[model samples]
Target: MMGVVYTTFMDMVAERFSEDVLDEVLDDPGLSTGGAFTSVGYYGHTDMIKLVVRLSQITKLPVDTLIEAFGEHLFGVLVGKYPTLAEGRSSSMELLEVVDTAIHVEVLKLYPNAELPEFRCERLEPSVLHMEYRSKRPFSRLALGLIQGCAKHYGETLEISHESFDSEEQYETHFTIKRIQ
Candidate 1:
């Protein structure tokens, strides 16, 4: 994971929870980074997982929920940091369909060491999008939250359906998004 992710997560926690809770979570001995993170650095992916787990314990919210909320919050940070990516995109679906081909490509250029999820997308109908998300790490809720955030950002509403599966060999999720006017 990149430090930008950790920094956004820290910002989200501090805004939603207390700054003290963020401090306490970072203060835990298990984190190798000691909770000090910079947006331009790289950190172990496990560090983020540990922090989210600790935050979940403190807030009594599910870890997945926290991750999803963080994803929603992270989208705003991403837009603020990378406005060119959003420029010329008129709708949420327009932005989402190009995530793998455009946004992730730009992301890799900026943060070469970053590990990102794979999103296979298909436009099944004029207003419907079918997508499959695959990642070694489990963060489907986060992806869903991102999808919701994008729709909100574009001033659109969607009916989203999804399924998740985890086996020894793989973790995969399928999402069906239908734009609603």
Candidate 2:
């Protein structure tokens, strides 16, 4: 995983919880980096899992809920860092349609080794989008949250539903997003 993800997660922890809580979350002896992450340094994906699990335990929130919330926070962080990703995009579907093709392409230019989830999107109707997400990591809920964040960013309301398939090799999810208002 990219270091920016880990760093952004840590930043979200500090901002949503507290500096002291962030310290507590980072005190895990099992963390390979000792909770020290840099935006330009790579780390194991398991490290992020451990941190999120720890945060869930401390906050009494479900792991999925925490991960989804983190994804929403991450979207904001990414947009703040790279404004062009959302620039000239008129709607959530418009932005999402190019995530894999344009946005991830830019990301790969910066970090060639970054492993990003694949998104296959199609417009089912003028107000509806069908998207399939495939990833080695089980983060469909995170993707959902990111989608929600994108809709919110565009001041749009969406009704989203998903079905997931999990296997030893990968996780796949099909999402249907409809503009409700």
Candidate 3:
């Protein structure tokens, strides 16, 4: 994975908690990167996973909740870093429809080695969307946060329901998003 993600994850922690808390998470022995991450570098995703787990323990919050919050923070970072991605987009659904085609495509161009989750999105109605998220990493909460963040960014309201397909080997999940009228 790209180091930018790890950097953003750390930034999220620092912003939500404190730099001291971030340092504590990084100082843990579980991180392979030794808590040093750069936006232009590359590292193992496992390192990030360890960091998140540590943060969860420190904050006494669910791992998924922390990850979702990180995802929301990352969305804001993306908006700041790549304003063009949101250009001409008026709603979360509109931007989401093009995430793989437009956003991920651009991310691959910039960081070819980055492993991103696959999203299959269908507009069930004008205001309802059904999306399936599949990833090797267990980071669905991050995706949830990003979806929520998008709605917040677009000044829209939504109700999100999700079910996870958990097994011994992999993770798959479905999200039902209904834009509140």
RMSD of 3: 1.4
Counting clashing residue pairs in each candidate, in order, gives 0, 0, 0
Worst ten in a row by lDDT for model 2 = 147-156
User: Clashes in model 1: which pairs?
Assistant: none
lDDT tens readout by residue for model 1, 70-132: 888888788888999888999989999999889999998987777888899999998999999
Local accuracy of candidate 2 as per-residue lDDT tens digits, 1-181? 8888898888899989999889999999999998788988999888988999999889899998999888888888889989987899998989999999999999899788998999999999999999999999888988998998888788899999999988889999999999998
Error of 2 at 68 (Å): 0.9
The better candidate by lDDT, 1 or 3, is 1
**Winner by lDDT:** 2
Better of 2 and 3 by TM-score: 2
Q: Is candidate 1 or candidate 2 better by lDDT?
A: 2
Q: Which residue segments of model 2 deviate by more than 4 Å?
A: none
lDDT of each: 0.88, 0.90, 0.87
